[model samples]
Target: MLIKSSKQVSRWRTPKRFPVSRNSGASPASRIEPGVSWPEPEGATRVQRFKVYRHDPESGKNPRIDTYAIDRDKCGPMLLDALIKIKNEIDPTLTFRRSCREGVCGSCAMNIDGTNWLACIRSLDEISEPSTVYPLNNMDVIKDLVGDQTHVLAQYQSITPWLRSKTPAPAGHERLQSPEERKRLDGDYECILCFCCTAGCPSHWWNGDRFLGPAILLQAHRWLVDSRDEATGERLDELEDPFKLYRCHTILNCTRTCPKGLNPGKKIAEIKLMIQQRRS
Candidate 1:
């Protein structure tokens, strides 16, 4: 929704003022600051390679990896910094999902060095040369580095993550619970829904549709254990299917891949235990 007037577009196309840096002869187009040039003479000293996955589903073609050589010194410490730099300086066609520039948004989840991580949180200095990045594994690619999250999101929606009950709340009163009851939400609510846990799980890769997967199951457990939620039995009943609850084979990938350190395996195990206790 860029509603730029014709005048503004013309002005941008033909800038009256061409600010030039005293050092690098950089024009306004590549100015890093008011008068500083991007890739400052001393800034870009070494080369860092990036192998990014590229594919647009709109075009009928096989996906391929594209390599970019970046000036290591020109990039900021984080991996997202290097990506943004590459997009700005080398190739605008390169694309990936990013927002908030912080880990909380959960929008920038992708593989770095063959492991899932939010690019904003992984420091560029920590990784070696020829860093490889890709979208979450085995998912539909809408474009370069962007996966179609429609299916995973739809699965998340199926769980009814919010509290629901046939009973009505008292008028003008809030549902209250003890601090201990609130503690149960700690690990589960902390999940950013980045899909790292589910995407990394071999079991989920095989039984995704039937299993509900770790990310979905983790949030399901969150609502199921809420003190004010009266639908515990209903939630448990829904998750009792063998395929949905038992597909997890404990390869520990879910626990291993979580950037937030959440153990979806543990959460799924609790769900199973809860169901077992109910039956007994």
Candidate 2:
């Protein structure tokens, strides 16, 4: 085959018409950015070590901890800040899930300093000891610091996680809740489903499939206690199985490890009480 000239090939390969969208015309339409990163933080003299767990299922290798150095002054105070810095500057391959860096999203749950917490909230400067971060323990890692949230998410979906009331409210208004009725949802509403409570649970780790676990049980109580929602019996029916609800052996790890200060154990105890009362 005859080869084309260099100029002909270059003209043939270069894109000619980049049709711009009307909405995105004012903004840069191209998603690709140059391989550029911020230089090491200025005025940041102190360096802190982060032992981050690294894994790649595609590589066919065992997991290992990779050390990364971060300039304390250069990074934000939270552990997530440092992790993001590492990902953005040092290694773009480093991966973890994070949203709403204020800890409200619960997406950054991981084992930091031997405790389960939302990395966005855990302050790096608060702990004087050296730090090691791992994905939520006992979870199958899809990548570094990303646990398979399917189990907890499936259990959460099993709860249906919404009001299932059949009773219709007045024509012009929605179902109104009283102060007392709304108070019942206080502790349960705070759960962000970051998997910290379930991940910290030893019983959950052992029987995660059978056990509904703390986070699911917590949502169960959220509905069971809602006075405005008239689905208590159904909620209890969904959770009354011996393995599903009773497996929470009051280990209290769910409460102790909850970053939101909500007691999932106590709320679980409340669900047990509801089941017992229904039987009585």
Candidate 3:
């Protein structure tokens, strides 16, 4: 898709500092991996306090943290599990969106203690201090932990997330390609569209209402790489606008915040390369 030029450029590209690495230059605790499970904190039988942000839009009330106390032992599970236990046993009004607790649905993405994570995937033991949970940054919060997904859904719709073809199929089975061809969009096809990338993005923070963020760019690139996609030119044209593609300054927030390890920054870069190669 071509981005229209009438859109204004944003100054969200300013640099900022990140926290120091805690594991001798290794990845952070919030990193996601299959078959990895988090244990309880080192030593604590006492109560654990959780500070979760609350939002009630109907009353025009400002968002604030509401505290909850749970037995530290039972809370050692995944944060999602703990939150569910707390709500079922303590307060039902504590609100958040989640499904497919196995981390596939991408509904549980949130800012936990200043980082984005799918609560079902993050172990409570990994959090070192009293923690705070909030909706993803820079999005309209619909409730305590649910941000408005309208922009995100619109971007997905913009890409037409399914396969499209302009030619009629042959008289046999569909066209086939080598394994290598299928791998062209390997990691990108796994995207769950959780908005973690956009949430971490400073550009999205400033231009979310206008620009299509990394997540959208990644999806665009995914289709661009698909061997079966028929409208590559049309897709590239849609992204030509300033807010649609050029807004990305390679800040890498989308890469860092993704719970599924999908690199939207890398995808955008690849899309740029494809665009350049097509021009050449």
Candidate 4:
């Protein structure tokens, strides 16, 4: 959920400086330690443990997992609720992105329990063990759970995601599509651009600078299949590069890790087939 107060938003925007620890040189696992233990409220039962990644680049200390004990009885059911509790009551310095707690915003995507997930929608009850939360893998961490998305956002813009048509609208009316034509956009249009699939893909981990990855590729295909769009040839030309579209090896990690359950692997394959068909 978005920070409710302007003051809270200001506090979240400013990264608090943490004192550098003597164990800065120790490995992250070796430095695993418990943080402040909030006292349970009266009648509160069932404490939940969270091993959260903490890092403040301005502090000059290495990243470490700080364990926090949360009173589940006092917290909400979702994992994001625990995080909010931690920030509000336990430690304000702890940082993460969240908005539209309903999971539509896609701002709360992070690495949870060795997989990328939207923390706002994932339930705390779903985690049987002490939950581990970290920034999305293979991206520069902005602070703690926030990953620098400059490259990914740039790649998304590179594809020109919006529809393009040479034909003008008839009599000032909007472009129209048949029901069957609109049905073609079902799976593709559901993508919220969370980048979970991209972060989970081994190919993106290795060649993210060039591959465009599954999330962006899926968006490209979304436009490619839009009946109202008329730039299919130009979109295909932009995605025809070896590293751009051919890097996907059908590993299906993108499909497996997608929080939205859309099949990026299949969309990517369709792009390749279209390229080949055009060449032939």
The number of residue pairs in model 2 that clash at the backbone is 0
lDDT, candidate 4, 1-280, per-residue tens: 3533211212232232236573665556335354444454455578788888887878776676777878888899999999999899878999998889987888899987767888998888776447678788778877889889999999999999898999987786788999999999998988898888899888998899999999999999999999999999999999999899999999987777777778899999999999989989
Candidate 3: segments with Cα more than 4 A from true spot: 1-44
**Global lDDT scores for all candidate models:** 0.77, 0.78, 0.75, 0.82
Q: Estimated TM-score per prediction?
A: 0.82, 0.81, 0.81, 0.84
Poorest lDDT segment (10 consecutive residues) of candidate 1: 5-14
> Residue 229 CA error for candidate 3 (Å)?
1.0
On a 0 to 1 TM-score scale, where does candidate 3 land against the true structure?
0.81
| lDDT of each residue in 43-90, candidate 2, tens digit only | 667877777777777876656677777788778989899899999889
Model 1 compared with the native: what TM-score? Answer: 0.82
Better model by TM-score: candidate 1 vs candidate 2:
1
State, as a TM-score between 0 and 1, how close model 2 is to the true structure.
0.81
For residue 100, what is the lDDT in candidate 1? 78
Ranking by lDDT: 4, 2, 1, 3
Using TM-score as the measure, the top candidate is 4
lDDT value for model 1 = 0.77
Which clashing pairs does model 3 show? 1-235, 1-237, 1-238, 1-239, 2-237, 2-238, 2-239, 3-238, 3-241
Worst 10 residues of 2 by lDDT: 5-14
User: Which digits, one per residue and each the tens of the lDDT, describe model 1 over residues 189-244?
Assistant: 99999998788777877778787889999999999989989999888888888787
